[model samples]
Target: MEPRSHKLYHLHGFHSRNLLDTYCSSKAEMPFTYEAFMYPMEKFHNAFSSGDFRGDVLIDFSIGPQIQHLYAAQEHFRDIILLKPTEHCILEVKKWTDSRTGAFDWSHTTTLATELAGKSDQSEEKEIRLRAAIKHVVKFDLNQENLTGSIGLPQADCLVFWNILEAISKDLKEFVRNFRKFSKLLKPGGRIMHYGALNCTFYMVGGEKFHFFKYNESDFRSMLSNEGFVITHLEVSQRKAESDLMDFDSVMFCTAYKE
Candidate 1:
């Protein structure tokens, strides 16, 4: 069956190019230099234009197509679909809340927290607490089950799971098992892009807990190799989190082909 769409989730704030711009703009006090800003943008453009990233139907599954550069490449694809997971997740969460609670009680924060914790233990309680507050006011729930079977991506030529592995659990075995399931979602021979930070904090998605794992290049490469993927490209970038006061000196971005 022909796939209905190509889904690219969390592209708004998480796209590397967007992040680079934020990084540059935040450091505007250092020097008002257009060269510094243009350099990264050019790099991102080149990467996307390259043959490695291919899909006729592109989907932006974030808040929206917040990326300004992608507009320039609209001609390169047949269709571009933009979706907001936040909205859907919120809707699902709300439905769940209403089902559990007879009436909409905006003050019921603990119940959401309990639900998020039960979904994933690695989730940050503080983040969950904060999301619960907003969720109570919003019209939706952000649970994973709500997301299941929702993403309809075209038969992807290549699938990129960039920088997301590090945000999963540290248990390598469990991580590989989970990833294998993700890989199966791809068409045979499709490429898999894997990017990981050496050390990073767990993330909370709309009140859900997602853990982070740290690994060196060798360790991660081996994991991919064992998973039946041929390592194509590996690039390392430095990661610094001022809020968390953590610095992951090296982050690896790997391009692997499913054989």
Candidate 2:
């Protein structure tokens, strides 16, 4: 497998739109990012609102620069730490958090989140909340034994991972090994929100192909169980085939707790 780079993946906000537009191809067909990310977020929102999932620190392990995956849970946590794989990805996120011109617009996603929260599509309020809530954005190396490296981060009450393991791992064993290391970043009984491709081998961004761990729903559940995580919520949505993009049968969204 080739080394994963920003060139092979979508590393900016606007590039993410290509993922939704090109691969999804239709407004009716939910993209993998949307289904896998947004659905779990909606669950987290409701859980937090009802005082079901209370947490002070939330950490995000990202595949790249994208931030939409954290929209639902942003307001619930007192602090948010974004860990990106590369310095380039870190800079990409900073552009938006810093409110620079030409930042990738997340208005659409914020609008959706507002509606989910039983409000009108008030995108500005959502944006303001996200900007204020994101306290730190730092570069992290997932391949390193110390996931956060020299910059120490507290063990989070909740961990969010989206398209991270599947995109970075060369195989299942590597995925599991990295997952174990990542789980250590959370406190005991800390909740996890995981989203990934199901049975997908590869995906494209910027006209380059990148690999994904090929696994099904059963594999995902068994792995979490073996890691001592009790699965509280699991949702798998059937994927629509987009010939030009990566071919996968489903997308998996999971919420689990380390026990």
Considering every candidate listed, which one attains the maximal TM-score?
2
User: Can you tell me which runs of candidate 2 are displaced by over 4 Å?
Assistant: 1-41, 241-243
lDDT of each: 0.42, 0.72
TM-scores for all predictions:
0.50, 0.85
Residue 126 error, candidate 2, Å: 1.6
Candidate 2 structure quality by residue, lDDT tens digits, 1-259: 4434323232322254455454322244545445534565576566557554558899888666667667667767888999776666677678888999967666666766787778765678788888888999977666567877788989899888877888767677978987888888899889988877688777776676676677888888888999999998788877744555676777777888999
Q: For candidate 1, lDDT tens digit of each residue in 1-259?
A: 1111212223212332332333223343423122222322233344555666565544332221122223222324444333233454334334433345432222222233233234334324433333332222221112343323454445545444434444433457755765665565456777654444565444323223334554677777787789788887777655433333223555555667888
lDDT of 2 at 87: 67
Q: Which stretches of candidate 1 lie over 4 Å from their true place?
A: 1-44, 57-147, 150-152, 201-211, 238-244
lDDT of 1 at 67: 28
Give the top-scoring candidate (lDDT): 2
